[model samples]
Target: MCGIVGAVAQRNITPILIEGLLRLEYRGYDSAGVAVLAEGNGIQRVRAVGKVIELQNALQATPATGHLGIAHTRWATHGKPAEHNAHPHMSGKLAIVHNGIIENHSPLRKKLIELGYQFTSETDTEVVAHLIAHYYSESHDLLDAFRTALGELHGAYALALMHEDQPETLYCARMGSPLVIGQGSDEHYIGSDPLALLQVTDRFRYLEEGDHARLTINTCEIWDRDNLSVDRPLTRYEHAAHSLEKGEYRHYMLKEIFEQPQAIRDTLAGIVGDDHVLTAILGPDAETRLVDIANIHIVACGTSYHAGLVARYWIEDQAGIPCTVEVASEYRYRTVVVPDNTLLITISQSGETADTLAALRFAKDQGYLATLAICNVAGSSLVREADWRLLTHAGPEIGVASTKAFTTQLVALLWLTTALAQVRGKPADQIAANVKALKDLPAIIEQALTLEPRITTLAERFANKHHALFLGRGTHYPIAMEGALKLKEISYIHAEAYAAGELKHGPLALVDEDMPVVSVAPSDALLEKLKSNLEEVRARGGQLITFACETIDQTNDSNHEIINLPFVEGCISPILYTIPLQLLSYHVALVKGTDVDKPRNLAKSVTVE
Candidate 1:
């Protein structure tokens, strides 16, 4: 998860590059750097170990102004977060910024070392700069050298390179990672995201896998993986800058949390029609695909994986089709026994998650019925490559800790469940009833948002908590997992989630007076079973914090605290309960004085493995 921004223009690109880097701050980074073709000279670069402001301050002190440049905000991989490992790594006249990992860098670094190349940083990216520079030494053509260098590299990458000799041109390439070219009058740009280049250009072109381009101020020359020149479509893209602003909220996390009501409404708007679920929103082949579906193989990472886990319960309970959910990172390594007519589903907010995208590719050949990408970004590699795509309208999830994306995904999955159930012989009225329930979800979640003040007070107790245990039953188990993930991600608490039944087997041992045990007590079939597990935590003298339904008769005692939420029907309970957990994490992070929007050691869109 790194960011890349490049520009080839006749004007001062310094301010533009710095602002682009600032726009990419949401993606998360430990080190930042910029490489520019110096004013009437060779290449110049500035790198900083901390925030982008440090790089900005460094630039203000000693500017590297040029018309052609590439900037990067790196989320460390292959090396620690340090100025030495920062991007804009150089080799003589060539300066390069890269996002994604180079798997064969170890061997490449060794080979380059023997060829009279001296390494300065312990980064795999430095090898790319040296490799390109090595080839440039022989060919004297920068594009030819870049293509040759790309051919030698293994694994995913989105690279932007600049040559001192080619002052007016910017070289960029994408292989299993996202890269976009911005079209402008007498100027062009390349960025990992369209949002970063919005100030300069409205029209953008997305590069597919193995596509490379040479960009001049007025021209964008492209080539496919076969060294064939190709032209990618240029389409106008527009986003209001104020839409990204936090406004009244202190952090993007808080903004997105409140945005969930509208976000879910938007996600369902395309699919939920008058008393019926619109199956066509999924794709032309969705109904036909569901007809033969005997199983589902859901693969994703992080919060998306947890979303899949929740969908597993829905698919089985509603459609009567067995579903298995696995973390995308581990799915490819194991020998997967895919059943006949098994549908492979991959979920991601950005749709550019490296492991999930790679797993989707691997699953394509494993004899699945079809692959569907439930993604947010329409231009993401996963959406472009998948057989069928369901776009989640979460807008832009700028916060590293996802809120709206997760709920919007749940909404998408619920609609998908209805579509699947329809073809699988579920009652039409029952399906319609479930879809009808979704229409009220926005209001229900809005009511849940009203419980934030209670959550804020509950979160104060967690400011001193270093460890937390989250427990849930049935579909809520995944909700528990997601809540734990949020708490750990933002609040920096050591949080773990276990199925309520599994608590006594091992986790109950960790429960004590100092330990906080949190649970979402939904009024479902498992409520009685979940209460027994809660008793186990209470027996262990743990601090019990329950986000229970208003219908449940509960009182706060010395050892326990209960925040009653607006009761909802069983079908949409998970979505409703999720809000309080999010608020809990946010308020807890605020109390702990932690960075709520941009968390440490994490990136919003995990674009690399």
Candidate 2:
């Protein structure tokens, strides 16, 4: 994952570029850099190996002012995280910042080296700059040189390039990665995501794949892959700046964990009413298609993949449709049969996940009945490409470890499950009861947040542990996986999740006093079996921290700890149960003094393979 921002303004844009990089920090980056086309200095570039603050300080020591500039925050892929490998790489006449991998960079680098192009960095991006510069030497036209260089390259990229000769212009292009142009009065902005431009302007144009653009103070011109100029629709994005702020919370992760109640409420608003469940977002033929679907294929990666696993249980049990969940990266490489009348569903928070997008495109090439995306971003690539789209409305999740996004995804899946059940001629009373339960989820989530103080205390017991195991049964198994993922992501603990029934198969052997077993125990049909599983953990001398419903009588045991959770109806229990685990991870990370928002070696958005 990486971030790129470019600007062309009538006034100095160094401050804007730096601020944009600061906002893009949440995307996760190892190095920061900026290149500016100054009046007399030509293209002045500065880079730092650590944080954006380092880059800011570097710029202060050797200041550069310009009206046209580009900046980047890189999460290293092709090279080590160092000043030499940082972005805005220069090649005599051109400076470029890129946000994706070039698959053929090795061959191209070899060719360029043979042609007497000297390399200074171990990055695939450096080749692009040199290639463009080589083309410009012959063509003498910036756009044509860029176009020819792009034609010769292979792989995913979102590039921002500036030429020393053309100090007032910025050229940008995107293939697989995300890029957008923010329109402002007498100024124009380009960024990998809208967060970079939220403080500057809300009116922006999202570039489609294989699109290139030239930005100037007075004009913004977009060109298609075929070298024809294209008009991209400008949308007025209404995301408030305050939504990205931490407010009173110490970190965005904690604020997001507490924001789950409102996030789920916004996700379910108008879709679930007291008397009916709206299926209109699935398109006009949702009713007939839902009932006729033969199989359901859910594809996602990371936390979104765990959410899909949870939805598989709900879809099969409630809608009577056979469901299969697959990790997107693995699913794309394998030859899988896509049966007719099968619905393919994708889940993502940013909707820009590269693997998931590739899997969705692979499914599209096959003969699936329809495509549906349950995502947070409204106009993201996943939403725009799918036949049906449902926005989670979780707002901006800034933390590298997801909390609100995963819960809101479960909310959307639960709604989809009920909609399918209703279309399948399930009893009206049953559907209405589920809809009523859905309406009360916000209150239930609020009740769950009340347990945070107690969970924070419980987290002290886990803060020093080297490893942990999470256990759950039936539908809650996926919730266990997500809880384990959250704990390991933020706290740096080696955590693993096992279905309660699968513990004896292998994972139970790792249980000991040093390894705590955290169990997500809801009062469902599998409660008795889950209790039995907990007893096995207790017998193995594994310290226990169980999240159980209040009515469960397991608290009387003196050997184990029990954190009471709010009792909720039906499949909504998983969504409610996720809050305490999130708090546990946050508090544990806080206790360990780790970076709760930007975890090491992880990025919020995985835009590259």
Candidate 3:
């Protein structure tokens, strides 16, 4: 995903746009560009490969000024990262900056070529600009021309356009990617990220699918697909004001990690109380039906999948239901035998994730008895499709790494387990005690974040390792997989996760003293079995970093170090155990001097297939 922003301001817009680009750079860093409509002049454009600083320096070399403008920090899906491929792609009269892929770009390019439009760069975005220019020649107005061209386009996109013919206004539209309109004094802005508008304004309207906005210096008009003008409500963003400040922390990642305490407290407030956990959606037969189900099929993408993995153990042990977890993409392609009375649970931070949403639709089509979704967004598509829903009060998770959302999902899933146990007629004392544990999770998580120093130190040991393995069993297996994914994505480390029991099958052959193995060996029933597995690694001379519930006194046999974790009940251990692993991967990436937040070639949302 790339970042796109546009501003029509009473004052000079270059600085505002540039500042906005800086905030949105986490979305992409391949290249940066800006196009502004100059007074009594045509569109002035500047672009360069690399970060915003490079574009800033390029702009300094040859400056462009205008009050109405659009800018993009590109992630380069369609072409290489070069000046020619950089965004703010321009035609004779139109300039366009786009995010998301145009899947039919080849056919669109061919049609435009046949229509006598010359293309300058190898980009799907360039095709859009040319298409607009082609139509503007006929319509004589930018907005009407834009509507005509967009009618032919396909795939996910959030586009912002500035035209020489319509220099006073910037037009924006969204299909799947995030776009927000910020209201300002004598100005109006559209940005892919809310952080771009944080300094300029607090009030913002989140543009929905098929919505378009025309922004002028003093006015903004939003329009739907049918050409009817509409007004979307604006909400005051909570993090808008405090966003720019590093405040009491050194980096946003660390600040967000520490903010988990407050995040948990905020998420748990009102949702759980008086020794009873609650879901945003609850029914009398809901818990009983879920527990009575023959099987569960949990589907999600990225960090949400990790949460599902944790839930698998809870559902299996506590609710006595068989559970299977799948990556939504693969799940969609596979021929799934939907067992009758199966509950298909789809989890997503943003319920609009292309693959996850498709998976939910597929599950419904196959006639699964009940489909439930755990998500953060209120009216997201998955919520509409599911028979039941649980909302994690994680607010908006702006960062791509997904800190707060993952924790809140864990809270919700753990609550689901307790509720299922209760409805299945579990003893009162057991249900009450488990509810008490769930209530105390926020405090326990706060205590966990204090392990920052320990995690940081552990990170140093593995920072230089080229290859690694994350091993776990049962609930911890998915956590191991998540940790490996994070390590590989952020640190550029070659890592794989495997169940500890499955290690000897093939993965163990790659292990040696030079390679590090991070083990998730919590104090569960399989702890002794996991201990013997760790011994196998030691016998093979593999360096070890073990995360366990208790301290290991015998640390001499190829064991590197042990990070003690909070000992909780087996049902809820995955939630608490995940904290250290997340911190460990985060710190390792930090120590390796990698871009922990944006990680190369990764976007916060997968809007396009």
Candidate 4:
């Protein structure tokens, strides 16, 4: 994800702009830049190839001061992570910062080159500056030029622009990307995330799709999608800004991992009971929609997709409905066949994930009974667009690898499973058992975290290992995939996960004394099959580490190490098994000396395709 922040204020706003960029550093970026309309310096800019701190250092060396400015943390979508390719891409007297892909930039750049516009950087964002500036030259009105330029754009973007002539105003626009306005005393700000502006102002207004605005010290005029002036409702953000800090933890990833128990407890606080899950947790009319009998379709990306995969098992086994999960990017690009009463569900942590949002938009036209958004951000575009929503109350997940968020999403999915089970005439005894397990989830996860010291010792063995295999059966298969993903993401280790049954088919050949294999052996019906698979690995001299049910008779030998998990049944087992896997990755990444919070080449929120 890319970060964008802009401000027009009464005092020199350089401090405000840089502070916003500092807060947005967690989104992950390889380059940073800022542009300010200096008194006589006509849109001065400072750029750096790596880290927002480098940009801050350069800004201190060569001060770029103005009452108005724009700053960005670029994640390298259209160009390399070079100073020239950093954001605040300028053309003539105009400078702009952008966050999303420009699909038509190639053709637009060609047209501008033929029109005598010289390109200085290999960025699609620069093409946008030239396009806007070219229009500005003719219209002489910034908004008019912006309006004309917006007509030709063919992709997602959240833009902040400043022209030399518009010294007192900042131009902003949002299309398919997230942008919010921060209101303050005689000053206004725009940030891609509300957290970025918390230091200056908590009062914010989320820009709707196709919303464009011109901001000055005392005014923020927003145009609706229909080009008519409108007022978006204001939100006074109350979530603690201090939650972003790591506190006593060595890394944010560790802090988030330890926070999982509380996160799961919060997620199940009101929705679960002693014996059954409240169906109304989906919505007041949830059962009204659930009564319609058919299968379900789940769409998501990355970690969210793994949550969907786990949900397929619960929804199918408990609710007796066919659940199909698809990656949102691929799902959006193809023709989908929706069966009757097929409810479309999209999972996202940010809820601003570009492809997931696009897929949700596409699913709307597919004749689904209703749309449900399993999201973290209550105000995100996905929640607003969906017919129903179930928030994964995992709080703020600053880590790029996603620890608490993934588990909380599973908790939310369990809630959905019980709701569907009740309405679909599933066994009352089974529904009660599922809910009873969920109620004990917080304590189970807390016990699971106790294995951290043991996992830390086990992770040391993996620090030097280059390749590993993960094996699981049934719902735990997705948990194994998630474990593999977490390892690859933060540890930079090459890991592959497979269904335990698929061992003889291919993955077993790569196993040897040097190859470390991680397995999730829950005491489900597939335990016998998983045991046979583990025997295959042991016979091949594969180094083995397993998170197992305590009931499984196991002894740690030279090749096998077992970390016992608190036993649980039904839908809650996968959620419990996920805890040890998370700690394993965290400690492995710790041993590998990688940036656990913001891993290389990854962002916490994937706001762009």
Candidate 5:
């Protein structure tokens, strides 16, 4: 989940490499470093221990100019976040920046030590530079040395290598993680993402597995590991400039969270026109198969898995389908039977989640339909392998902890459910009513953002609390679990979500007056049961703050605090319920004086599996 960038040009390359690192900051920010090949001198390296801005300030303090350079913003996968553990690691005449884990580095490190190689940092990336230096010492050509060094390495990586001997060129290679080459008139660039090169050029080349590129001022030469020449692939792009803009918010997370209103509008734009409500859901063969499905297997990882859990409730209640939600990491190992007419659906933000991709392949091998992926990225592996696909219009989620992507997944799954119900001969009136309610959801979510202040105030009380419990039932059970995940992920708090009914089975014993219980008590068919569950917590001396549609004034309750919400249908409750929880986790982390943007031990993308 680190960021990688390199540029080869006749002119000085410091500015371009810096800008590219800024654009790729979302992928990583724990540490940053840059290496430039100076004209007369050897490779010059600079590194810092904070964000890219920190590195920028350091560069201003002591800057270097060169025609060839490589840079990285590290995410701390292999070692601690130390200045020495930062990227642009150098060994003798070579300097390199790398992404992904070297799974066999411990053994490889011992082997290198035996071969008389010394190390200055606790990182897997350093091993590569040392090995290349070892190879370059024996072999004359640096490009062949890089290929040979890579062949000896194990695990996934995207590497950018620069050396004093090869001052005019920058060498790059990719295995599991993403790396792309951008085409410009006078220069060719390699970066972790398109945004890094969007301002430089619209023309690009997609790097393939076992592919390596040697870039220069006016040309790019691609090759396989065996040194066989390869051709550059065609370009692909997005709304590059608009995406680069921060728009109106302070942080990208807040901006994306607020953009949900418009995002939801865009998602529902064509679903209801002059004629039909679920028209957008009708794909080529999707309607026919969905109507006749005997069961649905929803596979995803992390945040996407929470969305799948919500869909499990929706599809089963509305479309009369039995649904199973499985974690993609564990799905392949279990020997499960696929019933006839079963629909296997995979959900991913990038559509490149390694385990999810493997799970889709496993399902395909079992002779089920390839798969259907609900993904944001258009050309990702899961999307390409799927038999059918639904594209989520959430744009780009730069933040590691998801905000808009989860909401749009729920929206799309609901629409898909409504369409399938109609095809299954459900009353047209019921489907129309659900669509109308969904159309009104964006405004309700806008109103929900107003709860930020109250959530902030509540966050103060829980900042010192080391442990917490979240509770919900029915459609919102998954939301409670997701809320717990956000807090634990970003706030570093120990949190757990129980199915409300399960609290007394064992978890209730952990509750005391000091421990807070956050409850998602949205009105539903199971509301009475959930209300009873809340009363049990109150009886056991648990401090309670709840998100609910029921009135605090009407309840006459003196012990517990309630955050009242606008009345929305049970199916739509999770959408609105998520806002306050997100704000709660955000403010709690702020109050605890923890890093809210990039939490410790977590990366934006889990590319290495």
Candidate 6:
């Protein structure tokens, strides 16, 4: 999980490269560096140990002017976060910035050492620079050198290379990681994501797997796996400018939290209409294929995996389908049984999550009936590789601790469940009722946002607690897990979640007055049983913070605090309940004085294994 950007422009491109790196800092911030091919000098490089601002300050002290440059903000996969391991690794004739892991670097390093090459950094990226330099020494062609270096490399990577001999051109390659080429009037840009290039141009071309490109000032030439020239169509993204701004909010995380209403509405716009009618967005043949599906296998990672867990409940309850949710990293490494007519569904916010992408490819090889990707990005690898796709219109989620992306993914999963239910011959009235409940989500979420003041006060109680426990049951059990994840992610607190009933088995022993217990007590059939579980916690003198619907009875006990949420009918409780939990984590992180947006030791996207 790192950010890489390269630009070839007619004018000096140092500022553009720096700005792009600043925008992409959320992806990674352990270390930062930039390599430029100066007009007179062969190559000038600047590196820093932490943050883009450090790199910016270093650049100010020693300025480097160039028409072409490549920059990187690293997440420290191969080495510790240090200046020596920072990216834009240089090797005399060539410099490179790389994202993703080089699994074969150890063997390659041994071979390079045998050839009398010396390394200055502990990063696998340095091996790439030296390899490219060695290849360029042979052919003297930058493009051929890149191709040769790529052939010798193993594992996922998105690389941008610049040669001292070819100062006006940039060579790039992608395999299993994201790389996009932005088209501009007098310049061309390469970035890990489209947001990095939005300041310069909204038009971009997404490079497919095993694609290499050579970019000049105004032209870009793409080569496929066979080394044959290919043309990638340009797409003009409309909302890039607006999505990049924080608007009136103080932080991008808060702005994104408030944007959930619009995000959910945008995701639902074309799929649902008046009178609770559902239109088809999954293509015309989806209904036919869905009806024949016997099972659903959902593979995802992190927050996306929690969303999949919630979807399992919905799909099984609503559509009567046997659904299995697996962590993508675990699923790819194991032998899974795929029965006939099984549907493989992959969920990811970036769609470039390495494990999820690998899991999807594995499922493709198993001959599934159809593959579906529920993701936010339009042209990401998951979307392109899958046979069916649904987009979560959450825009750019800059926060390392995900907020809007998880909620919007829940919304998308709900839609998928409802659609599958209808295709499987569920009653028309029942489907309409579910649609109506879905329609009320935006307003319900808006009401949930108003609970910030209440959640903030709750946060004050949580600030001092070193450990906490979250409890929920039934469909909302996964929501409890998500809440715990959010709390630990931003607040740096130790938190664990359990399915309430399991508390008596082991987690109950950890509950005490000092250990705060947060319970998700929605007004559902399980609410009564959940009340008994709360009593179990209270018996142990544990402090309780409960989120319940307005209809639920308020506890008179002083040790317990109750948060009355807005009444939401049907199975949409998970979506509405997530808002206050997010606010709670945000406020708790604020109280604890931790970095809310970029949490320590975490990256926004997990593009590497």
lDDT values for all models: 0.86, 0.86, 0.79, 0.86, 0.80, 0.86
- The C-alpha TM-scores of every prediction are 0.62, 0.62, 0.59, 0.62, 0.60, 0.62
Expressed as tens digits, the lDDT of each residue in 1-609 for candidate 5 is 468889988778899989998887644357999988888877888899988899999988988789899988975555667899999999888899987666567788898899999999988889998888888888887987888988887666789998887778888998755678988878888987777888788778878767888888887899976778999775767463247466655456666777787567645543442222432233334555666678899999998999999999889988899999999999977897898888899998888888888899889867664368887765577766787666666777777788888888888788777776877888877787778778789999999898888887889988679999999898788999999999998888899999999988999999988888999877677878888898898998889988988543335255588888888876688888988888888888888877676788987667667
Q: Say which prediction, candidate 5 or candidate 6, comes out ahead on TM-score.
A: 6
TM-score of 4: 0.62
lDDT of 4 by residue, 438-492 (tens): 7778888888889888888888998678888988899999999999999999999
- How far off is residue 330 in model 2, in Å? 0.8
Clashes of 6: 0
lDDT of 6 at 463: 67
Candidate 6: Cα lDDT at 126: 95
lDDT of 3: 0.79
Runs in model 1 deviating more than 4 A are 1-242
Give the per-residue lDDT of model 2 (tens digit) for 28-108: 567999988898888889999988999999999999789999999986666778999999899996899997667678899
- Those runs of model 4 whose alpha carbons end farther than 4 Å from true positions after fitting are 1-242
Show pairs that collide, candidate 5: none
Clashing pairs in 1: none
User: Candidate 1 at residue 354, lDDT?
Assistant: 88
Count of backbone clashes for each model? Answer: 0, 0, 0, 0, 0, 0
What's the residue-level lDDT of 296 in candidate 2?
Answer: 95
The residue pairs found clashing in candidate 4 are none
**Model 1 quality (TM-score):** 0.62
How much lDDT does candidate 2 score?
0.86
The count of backbone overlaps in candidate 3 is: 0
TM-score quality measure for candidate 2: 0.62
**Cα-based RMSD of the predictions, in order?**
16.6, 16.7, 16.9, 16.8, 18.4, 16.5
